[model samples]
Target: MSAFLMENKKLLLDGSVIACVEQRDGEWEDTFICMGENMWLWNRTFTVTDARESWDDFPMEFILQGEVAFYMIPGVNYNGNFWGEGKEPKGLLDDGIPWRFAGHRSGVRAGMLAQTKEAAVGIFAAQENPMGCSMEMERAEKKGFCMRLHFPEQEGPRVYCARDSYEAGKYMETTCFCKKNLVFSAWIVVREPQKQHDYAAFLDKAWEVCREEGSVRLLTDEQVWELGMDFAKNRLYFEEDGFAGFCMGLTWKDKGWEQKRDYLEIGWVGQNASLAVSLLYEYAIFGEKEALRRGLSVLDVWCGRAALPNGLFRCRFDQIRKWGGRIDNDEERNDAANLYSAVTELLEAYHLLAELGIERKLYRKTALAICSFVTQHQLESGKMAKAWFNDGRISDAEGTVGCYLAEALCFGWKECKSREFLNAARAGFSYYYKEFEKYGYTTAGALDTCCVDKESAIPLLRCALELFEITGEREYLEAAKQVSSYLASWQYHYNVQYGGHTLLGQMGYRTRGGTSVSVQHHHIDCYGLEFYEAWKKLAKYTGKEIWRERAEALWENALQNISDGTLVIKGQKRPRGSQDEGILQTRWHTKRGEYFGVSEWLVAWNTAFRLKILRKDFLARKREKSKEEKRIS
Candidate 1:
């Protein structure tokens, strides 16, 4: 034990040692060790050898500063023979680990037990021993025994008391005291590392490190070409050809019951519908019939005219449905809005299908049904309120809803060339423009309020830009510029750590004062990278190089700070007034350096859009550069 103490002096110097001992037949045995530091105790165990052959000594050492003393008590043995003789002595034996009764007035009592020697530690907090000393020992005998020591004050004499006993094995409990408060970090020593990464190939040959270590399931004709597979066999197709239903995203490999439940719950149909529309457009350009067919089927599902009679559109079935298949009123309205966007996407799919010369009456009927529903729901003001909410009224206005409406209206205008559809799109754009003008690019309402910054600002900016592109309206372009300018002003210029390059621009009076500068609310819901990308695109389209430069810098900073492929956004700073409260602050770190899922939906969409835009722009630049090079030559 002394040698072990000498060996682990560094760890011991940082904390006090707590020892638990058991005595049977006048022989003492050490059970566990706990190290106390700060205000928390960490549990550890060590092996000790008896100094005397007689085995009567219990020797433990703890370094102490200022006045300190030790207290002890003899173990009360509860042998089965003594129980028959009398209850008092047997009662003492029945309680497994001893207890300390001294600081009762201060309202402090604690218990410790070792479930097994192999386990690291055991701890229990109590105002008083619940089972009394005797019953505690009986319980310990059934399982294992435990011991607890209490040191109320380090400034005075230290006292230890034995209260009860239980079944015995190796376990430890620790306590620490400091002037302010105790900080705790658990040190766990497992037999094997919890996580492992492969680096052997990189070590051997750095160039070979780029090789992927996972399986690839190509779901596109282009992917087939890339993989050198037969085009016919590799062509992407829906699971049910000619049947309309949403495509599933990534599937879990484990196929566990919980994963299955989650799969059914959200459905993620809206995003899938968007993916399908994009894929269909790609298929038309690439002349891939299988991809085109699959995309058309998905569009049919989005339009709510699926092969299944009662199948809803891309409405996120589970979110809308409550118990007994009753739909939540608010969710139903949101679902309706989602379906509206899906229907608009279906219009695009129809155009692609027509271009591909795939004639199916299903597409026409689906399109007509969608138009009828949309027309029926239009208000006198040329905009439609969300449906299926309380009293079937749409009162609360949100940015995303307006964005979806604008998108749907644009689709309608292009498809039918209707004046009413154009007006509807204009009205949706008006809502966002007016709101942004009034709020000055800051999020309106309280921090706790729904449809906060991410929900409102980004969508509003997106719709404004789209409106400008479709209508060629200078007013819409100016409005988009205003919103973009406001968004850029709140880019969190000084601290890259706080809020991750974007601030929660809107705040209520109550929360504004208390809001932590560096802390990000999980509910803010905006994608920093997406905002940057959107601004960058707008800058390119408008020939505004400054906007492009600013957005590029923000994007680079965000990527540098908060991204790894598995997107975790930790709070970069402690909350206001938390410095003295003794809490650990948050940090941004991820396993994948270049990619992070900070906002999965936004990031994915933004990345796809940026890649498309950049590819086209790159080719144009390359052509211009080649022409110049030829002239020079």
Candidate 2:
């Protein structure tokens, strides 16, 4: 034990606090006092004896170094670094490059979680100081991975992109310069591993601590839905070549719209199919003819042109007119998650068509064909490939990408009544859940980043609920509850402190309930919109009010920073219903602007999903209330 471990109870494998005033400097003077069982406060103050004009970036870290365990930095780093020189088993795109970022890069919460067989630990630093926070895992003298939480967070060598490639990244330096005195403090919690090995236990405790400290939620679901629907109908919808759909994304720059032509994508950024489903729901509830026409027309395009011989469809459609309707030579690869989303949305549209007494054969045929092709590709291990070439050849098969397929297959079985789809769904779900049980983390739900991420766990929650609803199985409901815990680990249960001048701060953006993308991407988005229904189902099935509360929290997070058309950022007025794809909760961002500014690429899916859930879940409830009133009258 080092001098920092003054308590009788040992918290870490090698109980020591590694302090670095500079990269080469030795440990700085500090004081540690035990507060409670397995809890302590490390407080220190730096009064600069010799001051320079300014030091923009300096390396100073106070790390609670420990043995390598199942390490996770919420939405930031996952299970150590999965980067190396060669093509390794778990390498991501831009393979062979090392990756790490500042602590604020973590999703809703800025904390690190680590677990050994015997104990689990959570480390967090108050963000009140000028020095930001960051977590790193690298080989040291010890054989295990240690938790290195940096005070005055800094990413050196090169800064990373929160979106895709890091080749264009800028170098960033940490600064604790010019200050007369700097005070830094951190909270550390150590506890025995849960008996059932609940991997998210420490994260839950951290959330409790955060709640005790403070957090904020600013918007309600109703307000968000109204603003979101207005944006979707006015700005997102487009029609060309007899095809109607939502654009992939929109942008406002130099005080005007930047995208000169319409770009349509099927999923991820485009979310054309999902948005179409929302339009159909609007027609159903509000008797809107325009919504019905646009929704059906969008579905018609995919069903007529995009479907391939193997049942998989082309995901990109922007080049359709440019290519004179011939897009076979395009090099675009179809990701499993996007394809799954397309199929799910198609099935939903098919059901709506049937209800409204409209022709639905095309929608049904396309959805079934897609499901059949996906089921045919399942491995003997019950795992599905992550992406495939246009000709049906598997391109990449890794991570929990298959989790999305499982949910899609379950939906297929429910609508199409195919045993193959049902069997495939069950096998796929079981395989992924067992993998989660073993590793205690999910991975690669986002196509752009291949690492442990919260998005992958989302399908497990949906699939579990689907199976439970289909078979009335208690075990599946239990699985849903378990997966919800893992998903919660990625959610911010507290508000992250940001400088008042930053765009997010100006908007009073609440980090509470927003989800971080992947470990490689260090920003928050409304991705939690996908998890809302699963949480609500869990609440209904288990009578757990926490799940319901989480459902609302996730909803609010998804709806934050939405432009009411009057909202402006960087002198550009946001079109009504437009919300940025990324909320820069940290200094790291995709756009080169204010470090804490929102990524102003007003994405269609932001409004697409909000409108979707609003119509499907909330508006459906209101419809039921109206029907009951009519019966009573």
Candidate 3:
């Protein structure tokens, strides 16, 4: 063990030694370094006193100042820059804002990982702090970049009523804090490079560092599956004079559950057809006739009416007006991600119906038409346009947004046995993988935000794994492992502290395994559900237990805040089996204050994502039980 003492507390890193030294009047810092066989642990604690009488937040900022070649604060700043056009980020959570680059521990993994020429260093904080913490990375001129961890994290370009539409704005002033006495502690790990990139080395230690925090699972898989099915069939499912499908979902306000947005959206948040697939699962597993009828009815409506003339599918239906809706304009254009989702769900629906000896040629036909359009228009570089109108005109052409289509193409290839679909899928994955290698991250995955994000990495991982399975290629398997590190960065490794008054806190919500949405959207969601299967497969293929653990952890996180008929928030009751779309894990402005809570948008995807997973697990367990019973008999 080694200790250092100095006046100006700055962390020092040379090729041989990693240490920090700092001490001043009214401030005391203790630093220790313990060497291990493969990894070294560095511990730091700061004690400080404030003379000010009162303040809203008191912060203790710790710096792992060093000269490093690469640095990233996951889901936030990657290599101290933003991707895309040079324009400033538009929303309250601006991705391009200079210096004000701190993200709440809950919004990310609450750590900074950097790589020097020889080794990888990760600095992570414990999440039990009442005021929360934030991780920031900034370039320090000739000295390289500095990774700063903030306790009671406060930075400027502070936001108020962020993205609220009614009262949204930001300021350049720094968030001030004054507390009489404060103590902050964090753990640091230094390890040798183990993979082609340093991300894995740091992520490995990060998981180990936070393993003690553990996770809490509120409901069993069986209970969750049953509640979710009921919610989908009874509450979220919709029927009208001519149309039968699922509405987007209910929203909460001071009033009780309100079903104001009466629309059947095909993909993204609406997940009408996607949830119907879940209904099919319930029917297949539990033999519920209504589930089968409702599921097929919803799919039938979409398959019959959604195909557009220009070979694209209309993804949204305004139920109130009984008309098809186009995204972003009056034309027939649709966002790439939503369009990909619509195609994928249609393909899945086709598979289920076929298995039941039910002919759904319309479903198969519509999906193939849309996918054929994609393969025909695929760029020479394997890039697909972000959005396209029914007239075959491109709306937006830049960014990795087209990567969303990669998974859909892969599935389409399997169904049709078309080399065109397979080739496009391979090309798209290759292009996006190269882009990620060049930029150190993925971008524009989320439709609302056009900046670096974690969601885009999902398709990359899925495509890589799927390709590896189909072709038996080791290169694709390696790509999946690399992408897993990037995906892991977006997940919360520890349980974040929530204020007692907040809904999340009141319910004892654990942030662990909840994935942050993106850099521009500073919130957590069940997006992890999209890629847990890939993680589980990576574990099986690579024989790495860490990937398996992560997959399980992510499953539990997605189940948080699921309403079991009696779930209530803000003195209002939520429908059973419903779950909010976004959880405000940090001090970000939203409908639910600038603290920990939920956005009250009980999106259909949240329930659908869980139902899909639970249905799979439940059936597997039943199969195992059946085998055991047969053995005894």
Candidate 4:
């Protein structure tokens, strides 16, 4: 038999010190002498004879100790019991005898005669509680050594410490401590080495296969252009035609495949819209006269004129142009008016273009048409809705309609300097608040009254924040805060089976009468993280620190589950099964959840907005710091 020992004080794992030991001589025995501060000790002792002769039947023994409880790995089979509540020996292994253990363990194997120095173990420590302990190992080996330890604070304030040493056939002792109790986890992974293959040659063959498969004809020109722009933005290779189209349209049949597939699928459309708008803005703002003119021509084709009579412009072809069965008794009219509010964004784009002195006749005509339609539709309550189909009468004002009206009115107020438009905008904002005040600034029901009790509280909250920004009204700010508070109260907390807060724990599900159904019962369209970001901004702007903190926590939790650069949608509530129909199945059962596809777009937009607000905050902080430095000087 052989024995070895190696120690380095500087090498740490998650913030905890780790020491590895190997038994070489006859069966070796060791008892944990002491437990250190913020430390966890795990021992895996295997017989050398069995390991060498019958490698498959290697008899291994493991002992683990921590400040509080010992959590067994998912597949390791062992029995343990806790002796005391505080400073107690926990786990069946703590019963003063070796606990029976059996499992097909596969991981790093240490040779009995080999003594190699390895990095120290580290762990994440709790902020307030400081715990320390030590473990003593008895073996047939000799000599003890120590190394350096370092703990670096991360965004989550998690830390790690490690040490290494090299000695054979010796007893080992390790001591570790931290300012707080550390909660850290690590896993052992096992995988077979891959066989040699010619990746370059494989790719060349794949290209031939792709061409033969007729994959070149799959993507449209717009898609190809969007692909190029995205590649340019990321500094990735710009593939023209076949290469770009194939990469953007690939799909698979499994969960992993679904994730990659949705990215390519959604990216095809989203990237196009983003690239088109960005190009137009860039040209309008910074391009030369000729460049601006070229950009404008492209924008005109990409952002086609609305087919509906309502003066709204269609930014993309995918947006439903006509909500059929609507219009006054006159001939069938185009449906672009449904998205009248989106016209503000287009106008903003045009304004940027105008700044570059790129004058276009259509720009003025489109802008004026939108303004006139908004003016004509203003109702006495300061609310406006285009006439409903099959009925010439104006529809009742509510829900998303209020959001649209408020946005459009705000735009009109900006351009026309008309009190009527501003008043109408204010009234629409007020109407929404009044209707859903019971829900605490949340929208009470659908704008079109399609659903009975489902409230679009998120959109309403968003609109309220925007209104507050435009008007600087304290009431709007207060409404936003209340809505944010309502949302926080609904966050999921603990496991439902574990008696934890239900709503905020697993998923954010739609509720009626305080009862939430399974996620499978509802459409996943409501899933969005932007509302949290908006709340964070509202909190910072209004000096509501608590709201900001809560928003931060929710954001962190959501971000943790992102896999393959995509957010996973877990059960917000238990899935209700397949009863819920009409919704796209692709959007459901998505590994990242159905919302994964659109989440990037929403996250990007929200982040852009938040960054603008944060920039202001940053500047204020810098100014204050400078003033303080001057005073000190």
Q: How far is candidate 2 from the true structure (C-alpha RMSD, Å)?
A: 5.3
Residues 415-471 of candidate 3 have per-residue lDDT tens digits of: 889998999999999998998877668887766667777887888898899899888
Candidate 4's C-alpha runs over 4 A off are 1-275, 279-298, 302-304, 307-310, 313-341, 360-368, 382-401, 438-455, 466-472, 489-529, 550-633
Task: State the weakest 10-residue window (summed lDDT) of model 2.
Answer: 84-93
TM-score of each: 0.43, 0.82, 0.84, 0.41
What are the per-model C-alpha RMSD values against the true structure? Answer: 22.6, 5.3, 5.1, 22.2
Q: Quick one: ranking by lDDT, best first? A: 3, 2, 1, 4
lDDT of 4 by residue, 112-218 (tens): 01011222122111111111111111121232221111111110011001001111211112122221222311111111111111111111221222222221122
Candidate 2 wrong stretches, greater than 4 Å: 1-6, 12-67, 83-101, 108-110, 130-139, 142-158, 161-184, 194-199, 212-222, 258-263, 319-332, 472-478, 540-546
CA lDDT of every candidate: 0.34, 0.69, 0.69, 0.32
Give candidate 1 regions above 4 Å deviation: 1-270, 285-290, 304-314, 317-331, 335-337, 360-400, 441-449, 469-472, 489-520, 523-537, 550-633
Worst 10 residues of 4 by lDDT: 104-113
Whole-model lDDT for model 4 versus the true structure? Answer: 0.32
Error of 4 at 127 (Å): 18
Q: Write one digit per residue (lDDT tens) for candidate 1, span 304-355.
A: 4221222233254333223223533444433334544455556655665676
